[model samples]
Target: MSRHLNAGERIIESETLSGGITAEMRKLTIWTTDGFSRNLVLRTYTDSASLQHAEDSLERESTALTTLSGSAVPVPELLAFDSTATHCEYPSILMTHVPGSTVLADEGVDDRVPLLARQLVEIHAVKAEPRPREYQAMTTADTVVVPTRADAEVWAAAIDVLRGPVPTYDGRVLHRDFLPGNVLFDVSQNAAPSITGVVDWAGASWGPTDLDVAHCSTNLALLHGPQWGPRFASAYEEAGGVLSESTRTRQYWRVRDALACSEEVQSWAAPWREAGRVDLTPGVVEDRLDAYISMLMNASGQ
Candidate 1:
């Protein structure tokens, strides 16, 4: 349609769509004079501004993508990153438009399932000494998100669990947002999405591979629910993953992480609560807590 230039150098056009509340994913088709069609996506961060630390988020995203470029992950090449934290420029990251339908929204993506597992595993295999302290140093990424924050033990235990010497992840990049939307596929081609490439390395970190899996699990659950989560976990384990007790802790990390962002949960769920609707926000935190507790219990059992 109409071409508009965002920033000074890039001339881009984006349109909004219905469905999902995280950010606005605009269908961006970049223009080239040579009749070359390049379709890229631009995500304008629209998380509830009241609860959002926009500047910090953009900083994380920029760093994570930069690190991801050198890691094992297959991320879309970065086109531009502008973190206008103070200038109020709406921190944005313009990414290379990789071509693939979403595994969560679109159907007929069964075959590419294995590669999803493979990609996570391969990307996680990269090692970094002394894992970074927090994921935000990573990226405004898609870490396994839990929509609540009303827990205490989860926070303490996560520190205890991850306190050990960071596993050697080969310094490869972690795709903090290794979910379906960030993933591109060639479902039309028999070869699965080909993974074509990955998007949102903003939260890429030097942590256990399980962090990647848990992140995938949590995000996929938001879109596809439990069915997708377990299926993805199973596929990951089946594909020759070098599983260990430590890696399993990533699930606990996910719980702790989700708890940390409880405010967001309160935001999305607050409306329902004010209207005297059955409050699910408490349950959201509870579910995450139970998962964390279960992880602890299982470890004791072992």
Candidate 2:
């Protein structure tokens, strides 16, 4: 901590940041020699389980921040990282804080949806030399957790989509977890709401752009409504982001990502529940997921 701090600068405060499930996040306020305060965010993987992959996760995030440093994307500046936990209590990363709060309320999603779409376009457009690791699937057909009351036929169809071989795609940089919770927004009386920064790059990868879009779409479906899932895809196209030429191929990615969420729906809802969305019970999320899959299949004429 002392090495990362400027001469005569000292920590004045530390506050825990919520809405993250994987890592413990803290905001550190530093009082500098110039008599002003600045903030840095610390992300530490402290759990016994998380420790198993902490080094890899921290390495990915640090490399991502380094890769996107001069790009149009609004990302926090990486200050320091201890991927091995040798210099810190746990594997950690310290980065300059981006100003904004996550907006999870459903009322203004329509306004932010396009901005989210455009930001994703910018993110996917970045080129990385010796690209990040290939994206990995989080769920397989056998691993999918079907909702207790889900339409068996619909779920079977959705799961079947994943049983097929992974689709081939031109690789692009991916914010593998590009959901609303990872996006920061600034909403003020004086101006329109806008995205301020995107955080959580530990899952960054190189993959089909649709995978990133699918991840965010599934999250939007659970957070807002099933309609928002497909709505985001349309918004992405309007914002100049391209999807696969075949509807079947596009549906495969969408269904695959949506099913991945089913397996961890309960755990995923925990952070949103903590953030004041008590209405998003596990049961509700499961139902929304079912609806989103049905909608996808219907649109694809499956």
Candidate 3:
């Protein structure tokens, strides 16, 4: 691995990262014969199923990193990408590792919420040509289906309320899956936490900025509380990101995300159950989804 990036250097150690649903991450520590050392993240699929099912290919993510170079969005530097599996069991992208920890359910995270809001502002500020068709189907609420009796009636009504033309807005390159789990924070003793980088660009696309906003805000509500969503949205607007106060517009996105993410939340049940998070049950997720939908509707003045 070191030879691919640094000549005369060899990997001294490597560690695999867990908690990733799509791809496996490995931090490779490399040392040169002259004593220089550095760390790089080798991101690749663990199996053919993951490789094929991923939202974006390593090549696509590499292209995105290249395109985002010098942009306000904090992203890892793409060192190299190999589409063919000749060099490894699966295709991969090697990138400079951004030093930080993924903050999930941390007690000290409240102080850092504003910082995360600002980072999203920076991301939305980047200029890019519109890719309207990109991710339209995934973010569109019209296609949602209720899987069982647990979600049938409410899910059907949520879909009904969401029926309309997709709201048009100024297009920006979006971090489609932006959430606390995907953001890395550099935290130290008695120091302000700063976001080092936002990873997991697999779902990235050019689309309405509010999709990103709604996605993060909704996730914040689920992880924190109902109040966090409004707080985060307010913080985002205060940081120079334009978010419409129109309840209908807000509802459009919240509903879109609710429909799209419910499936994801349900899919996570197995993994959470395996990890012993007994609370991540179908009932819990359904309740959360229903609450989130209702929150959006009430906020939308329904």
Best prediction by lDDT: 2
Candidate 2 per-residue lDDT, tens place, 1-302, comes to 89999899999999999976888999999999988999999999988888888888898899899999999999999999999989998999999999998989998899999999999999999989879988888899999998998999988988899888887898999999998999999888878998889999999899999889999999999999998888899899899998888788899999999999988899998999999999998889899988998998888722
Residues 155-189 of candidate 1: C-alpha lDDT, one tens digit per residue: 45544544444443423345665766667676665
Question: Which segments of model 1 are wrong by more than 4 Å?
Answer: 1-13, 17-22, 35-37, 46-52, 70-72, 85-88, 105-110, 126-133, 136-172, 189-191, 220-231, 246-251, 254-302
> Per-residue alpha-carbon lDDT of model 3 for 57-157, expressed as tens digits?
66557666777778877889988777666677777778888888776553775787788889998887766543422654464455564555334565666
Task: Quote the positional error of residue 214 for candidate 1 in Å.
Answer: 1.8
Local distance difference test, per candidate?
A: 0.53, 0.91, 0.72
> What is the lDDT for 67 in model 3?
71
Judged by lDDT relative to the true structure, which candidate is superior, 1 or 2? 2
Which residue runs of candidate 3 sit more than 4 Å off their true CA positions? Answer: 53-55, 84-87, 129-133, 139-153, 266-283
lDDT of 2 at 124: 94
Q: In candidate 1, residue 290 scores what lDDT?
A: 43
For model 3, give the 10-residue run with minimal summed lDDT.
128-137
User: How many residue pairs in model 3 have overlapping backbones?
Assistant: 0
Candidate order by TM-score, decreasing, is 2, 3, 1
